[model samples]
Target: MLDLLNDLLWGKVLIGLLIAVGIGFTLGSRFVQFRYFGRMFRILGASQAFKRDKHGHLSSFQALLLSVAGRVGGGNIAGVAVAITLGGPGAIFWMWLVGLMGMATSYLECTLAQAYKTAQPDGTYRGGPAYYIARGLGQRWKWLAALYSVLLLVTFGFGFTALQSYAVATSFDDAFGIPVVFTGLGMAVIVGLIIFGGIKRIARVAEVLVPVMAVGYLLIAVVVLGMNLPRIPEVFLLIVNSAFGLEPAIGGSIGAAIMMGVKRGLFSNEAGLGSAPNVAAVAYVPHPANQGIVQAFSVFLDTLVICSATAFIILLSGAYDPASGADIGGVALTQVSLADHVGEWGRSFVSVALLLFGFSTILYNYYLGENSLNFFSESNVTLFNLFRIAVVVLCAWGAMTDLGTVFAFADVTMGFLALANLIALLMLFKPGLRIMRDFDEQIRAGIRHPVFDAKKFADLDIDPAAWEIEPEDIERLKRYGAPPPSASQPVK
Candidate 1:
């Protein structure tokens, strides 16, 4: 049943849905991805919303790390390899194309998450398709929200996390002859330590680790590209040529290339999958669109940066035989490719990379699972605790299993999750657009630093605390020598 459903959803329906939405959103949002691409960096470097408050919730930068932790993971490596193997090297062109348009889709979904967010008594926030569907669309849509939560729980919470662990285990297995079960147990312990510390720990770890791994991986890719300097132009040509069936070396149909690329790109960057917005909503940004732009940049980082690095590494090493690689897609292929180019040490380097990438992704998945259960009731402590255990157990179990089956199951559930989110996004898009307009108008008015006013949106379901700024809190922060209000986190 799952295979059949996955075949239909991934091969046919979701492809068009994803593409159409990406294009529509790209145009509708006035090229938000490109227009504000530079601003993403400005926010990253200058934004002071990264301070740790008394609560466990993360700041904007930490939230970006959390989201990136999920976005730039095993999928960026193994998943891209799978796409290239099945779809041909031309597949990367299609991935780039999807990524180009996905920025707008990411902005829309994330902005909606911020606008419709609800604050909990614990001074934390929770929002996503579930929250927005219920609050923005009305209580009549509560069932749809719950359905989304269930799908997300299955998709990110369990299935996808398992795949990350599986990739880690396989990489280690290929590298050191480490047994899968042992790797699984080790992974479970590491995951339990961080996840038990909750979102704060995850964010803290991500803020530090994500940048290091991403930059290190890119640096290695640049080094690899230098080693194959003459092949650089040829690599670009092959990608474009294969995408359009102009390259006969691929020996595959253009349709296969398009489908595989879109699938892997969607899974890797998670632009419209409705997963990132759950974390995006948790961020304490001055404007909802601020987080939207940050996450839009994240899509670029995931597909254009990390995944591209993996593709280049594999292609440059000349390790991927289209015919043979199709049967052996995933981290092992990457490990071999790096080894072929760099040396015997390449295998060990990739294993360590996989461990960090996959472990961070597991943290992302666990966070999403807790939010999913909380969607039903934040006070459901039993469900939350049990789900945490399930995540740890499944993370271990997944490492011991074949990942081909794991990826397929995740695709099916994610298909449904995206469908729910896309529908809600279209229906509730105006509020997000309104928020974007507010952001744009502020920029135009020379506000240099935009501060959101919750009272201006009294009609929406936004939690007032999210926009509220207490004088004493300001004094406390100032006394600690906290920086000025960032354009991301403005003072009231």
Candidate 2:
């Protein structure tokens, strides 16, 4: 069953759909991501409404941190190595291309998440692909919502939960001579403590750890790239030629390049996967667009900055070769590449990095599963907790299984969920555009602010308007902030 699933999903059908959705979003949104690039960075770096919230759950930076925690995980290390192994160096180029367009898709989906966000009874916010599917497309298609919930629970909770643990276990075994099973047990206990405390604790951990780790890894990559600076031009040519199957740097063929690039690129950045939006909706800020832009910038950070860093390090280290055995994938592959540059200690460092990256992703994925459960009932906390514990057990179990099968299951399930999410994005494009226009109008007018405030959404009927954003109040998000809802189209 798993093999069949891999055959069906890892082929052209899934790749085409993923690429098509990215293109559709880019075209549909009038390339808002590119047009507003400077504005997005300005909003992320500013500091003002750090504490304000109408019915707040997390600060803008906290939200960014949570989303980054998920994106910059095991995938960056293991996934990229795996991508290059199968897809060749050219795959790097394809990954970059998808990320470029994927920013728009992420913006649209996350904006819709904010647009239809539901206010929690505990004065918090909850929204994701499921919420948008139900509300944006109307409540009649409850099955769509239900299906999304189920897929998320399985893909994230069961499939990905275990995948993360397995990465941690493998890394520990390789670096410290520790048993994989005990490592899994340790991981479960840590996860249990943090998750039991809920999103706030998770957000706190992510906020502190994510930035430090991301910069640390990037610095390492810089060192590797600097060492091999002279060969940079040749590497660039190889990447381009391989992407087109002309250079054959890694057995140049269009099929190999496209497949490897698309697969790894999608896995690394997850631009169309619909996971980041879950975190994006919880930000305490003004306008769905505010969070949407933040989410898009994340894709840039993930693929353009972070993933690019990984590719440069691996390629420049001279450790990966298509004709040789050095083309290792995933965590092990990255360890090999890093070790080549930094020596034996580099393997230990890579292992530690993988542990942090994979653990943070598991934290975020669990939070997403928690939100999906909310669609059923707001107070099913105990059942969700149990489910998460079970996930921990499976994570341990996954450590002893075949990695190829483990990844295959995760890949197929994740692809299916992304398909559903992209469909939702396609259907909600019109409404998302209207919200963007509405937000821009409000920002241009002096009446609106940029932080979370229900007043900004009072005259608006969009479900996400359930809470309003105040422009003057949001920290790290002031430049593009808007004030109260404008009079242009007051809710009837």
Candidate 3:
């Protein structure tokens, strides 16, 4: 049943919808993701990017790291390997294409999220597809918003977290002979500790750990690639040829490549899946597009950089044979490939890297659930506490469950979640474009840093408090050469 459902969703319905929506968003935004690619890094490094007057609000950079933490997980490592195993080396080509198109989709959805974000009573912001659908589209769409929230809670809150925990436990078990149960229990305890500390603590941990783990993994992949420099061209040719069915290797059908690549690509970067926007909306950016641009870059980092690293490691090592029918796949394939390159230590390194990647993702996934719960009821302490406990328990339970079952379940839920968000994105397309245009107009007018003025968008249902500028802050912006607060711009 799971396989049948997955085939229907990934092979038929989602593949077309995802590509169409991605192309639509890209065209609608005039390819904003690529046009502002360089600006992404600049926005992250800008001094204003770190400003947060509220105690609980995340800086843009922190939010980027948090979203990246959620993105660069087992999907980059194990999921990449799965794509190769089931869809052939050609599947990677599809993954690359999806990542590129996803950049635009990510920008649109994330910008809308920031625009519709609500100012919570606790001095923080909360929003996502649910918030945008409800608030941006008005009272008629609240049910759709609620549905998206429920899908989010089930997909990221429970499903993805459990799957991540299982990945970590399996890797540890394979590497150190640790009991899966023991590893699961330990992870559950740690997850409970950090999640209880709230979003700030999660942000702090992501800020420190995401960069370290991602860089470390990439460094090792670089070493493997360097060792196989001569075969570099061969690997590229193989992926391209296999993707088109010109090279008839195992699992090399063009259809399989497209299906697997897109499935795994969405799984890895989550650009259009409504997941990252949860974190994206939490950032304190001068303009919604600033964070949107920052997040578009994350898709590139996850799929083009990190995931490609894992793929190259496996392909270049000559450890993975397309014709081999061996049961070794997923993290095992990655571990074996690295071990073949470096030695037994390579295997241990992958286990450790996966542990860190999966752990950070669990933290990120938990926050998404928490954010969704807040959407339903912000002040329900008992309910929130119970949800936290459920998260911890699910983390442990995930470790002990069958890996295939967990992954299958996650994929189904993720498909539905993405479907909801994509529908909302299509409906709210013009508003998103309007927000992007506001940022673009400011930039063209020579504003060094664009500030969102809620009054300018009074026609939209944005939360005024969320975008309100303090008098002191306005003065501070003027000192930095930002334009003064002015009357509403003519709505296009």
For model 2, residues 1-492, the per-residue Cα lDDT tens digits are: 877777677576667777887787678667888877777755655423454445445766788888889888877877777677777788888888988887888888888788778766555688888888887777676788888888887788778888788878888898999999888878878888888887878887887789888988988888888888898898888788888878745744677777777777777777777888888878755567878888888888988888888777788775777687543577777777888988878889888888888889889888888887877877686887787678667766877666677677777778788878877777777877877776666556652344333344444345533564333343223343433344432221
**TM-score sort, best first:** 3, 1, 2
What's the ranking of the predictions by lDDT, best on top? 3, 1, 2
Q: Write the per-residue lDDT of candidate 1 for residues 201-295, one digit (tens) a residue.
A: 77788888898888888898899999999998988898899999997857357988888888888878988889999999888665688889999
Q: Name the TM-score of candidate 1.
A: 0.92
Better of 1 and 2 by TM-score: 1
Among residues 3 or more apart in sequence or in different chains, the pairs in candidate 1 whose N, CA or C atoms overlap within 3 Å are: none
How well does candidate 2 score on lDDT at residue 266? 76
Q: Would you estimate the TM-scores of all the predictions?
A: 0.92, 0.90, 0.95
Q: All candidates' lDDT scores? A: 0.82, 0.75, 0.87
Residue 156, model 2: lDDT of 84
Best by TM-score: 3
Model 2 error, position 9 (Å):
2.9
lDDT of model 3 at residue 243? 88
Model 1's alpha-carbon lDDT is 0.82
Clash total of candidate 1: 0
